[model samples]
Target: MRVGRALPLAAAGVVALALALTGCTGTGSHADAPSPTQTAWTEAPTDSPAPTPGATAFVSSGTAAQNQPVFDAAIRKVLAKNAEADGNAVVAALKAAGFPMNATQVSQSTTSANLKPGSIMVGVKVGDSCLVGQWGAAVDGYQSTVAPVLGSGGCLIGGIPVVG
Candidate 1:
């Protein structure tokens, strides 16, 4: 049942990405947006970076597609860490950027062996979709995308989702 729902949401994401890309002319290196796998997050203005830029204020009443860019920007804010970035850091950064804690799910920063996991995932449930991100040495860096929520109506299958 959940898979059934995911297909359409995934299609919508493709459509949105297509539309977003269609308008770009790539005037130069800066004109070309970062590829999904693009790395290098840096130079935050403050300890807690600001929300999405004024031009792209979050669409509180919009679809997951509408919220994705804002969410990605927020994630980038947190990614400014020079070192020691973890799932908990992403959670706090998202929260500081105005994403509610209750709507976010995150993987444990460390494994049962008390070692950092290969990667960490953070997700914010938006409407029927999720804005998901993962980062670490294993992943070679950070990546963000829109995906459907799981059958359990959450993002990560094993993510720690705070309720209340």
Candidate 2:
């Protein structure tokens, strides 16, 4: 009788294990979730303004010296839509727009160990040039300022280190 009971229990355990393993496969409901590459654009407001027509010129050579205005404008557009977004969100937006993830950095300064409501900078290095964007409470408003990397490291103002 014990052997019979053990056989049934073992069969049930095997069945349960098979079902659990099936669920572990990536084909479940979570598979429908937007990937990191798609999340940024999907989360951005539908009415967000389009990048200037000339913005494409900036990425052509991937060098800041080629067309600073277009590059700056493009960065400004991305940051404006994500002014209130966190560092990860900003980096996601940049990556979704074709900026290399390895070349991008997000930094913020805080007084204590806790993150403070301070400035947020997103910098992307392309070739020898860098594009920097800044936005935060310290700034005038939700608008983000974008410019070519300066001597002080245009976008990297605080040396707070890259969080993402």
Candidate 3:
């Protein structure tokens, strides 16, 4: 079942448990049993995976429509919230500045990233090892579109030009 459907049942189970506990007054049946205590578990140590670097292609096995909002929101929120980033916001600014992307497609890859400010990078990949330049090219294309809207000598966050 979908998570939306399962949540209600899960909530009902919690409510039922609370009602059952509220009505219970005696707890003498298990008094003779061993003291209730949990044993601490120690996991066997193993080699840890290396940390993921900047933007990398992550092929999705799911629908892009479902994942697009999350990806777009993340990019938008980051650019909007940060004073140093302006890529995605530039796209929006360009649209507001009278230049809209004619053809745009954003795909989510399985790859994850933890990029520092001013060091963000994205990659388009083919298979496990083949990296594509489409992502970079697209950024440049969008930058060109936004540049005119921003005019000359304006600072940009990502692709969005920041005026004053």
RMSD of each: 16.6, 16.5, 19.6
Name the top lDDT candidate: 1
Q: Which stretches of candidate 3 lie over 4 Å from their true place?
A: 1-61, 86-164
Clashes of each: 0, 1, 12
lDDT of 2 by residue, 62-111 (tens): 34444345545555666677656666665655655666666566675344
- Model 2, TM vs. native: 0.46
lDDT of 3 by residue, 67-143 (tens): 23333334444455653453444344333422213322222322247433323232211112111111222353211
TM-score for each model: 0.62, 0.46, 0.20
- Give the candidates in order of lDDT, highest first: 1, 2, 3
Deviation in Å, model 2, residue 80 alpha carbon: 4.8
Report lDDT (CA) for all predictions: 0.74, 0.58, 0.34
What pairs collide in candidate 1? Answer: none
Write candidate 1's Cα lDDT for 6-78 as tens digits. Answer: 9999999999999889778554676467657534443422433334444245454555555666776666667
Per-residue error for 28 in candidate 1, Å, reads 50
Give the C-alpha miss distance for residue 101 in model 3, angstroms: 27
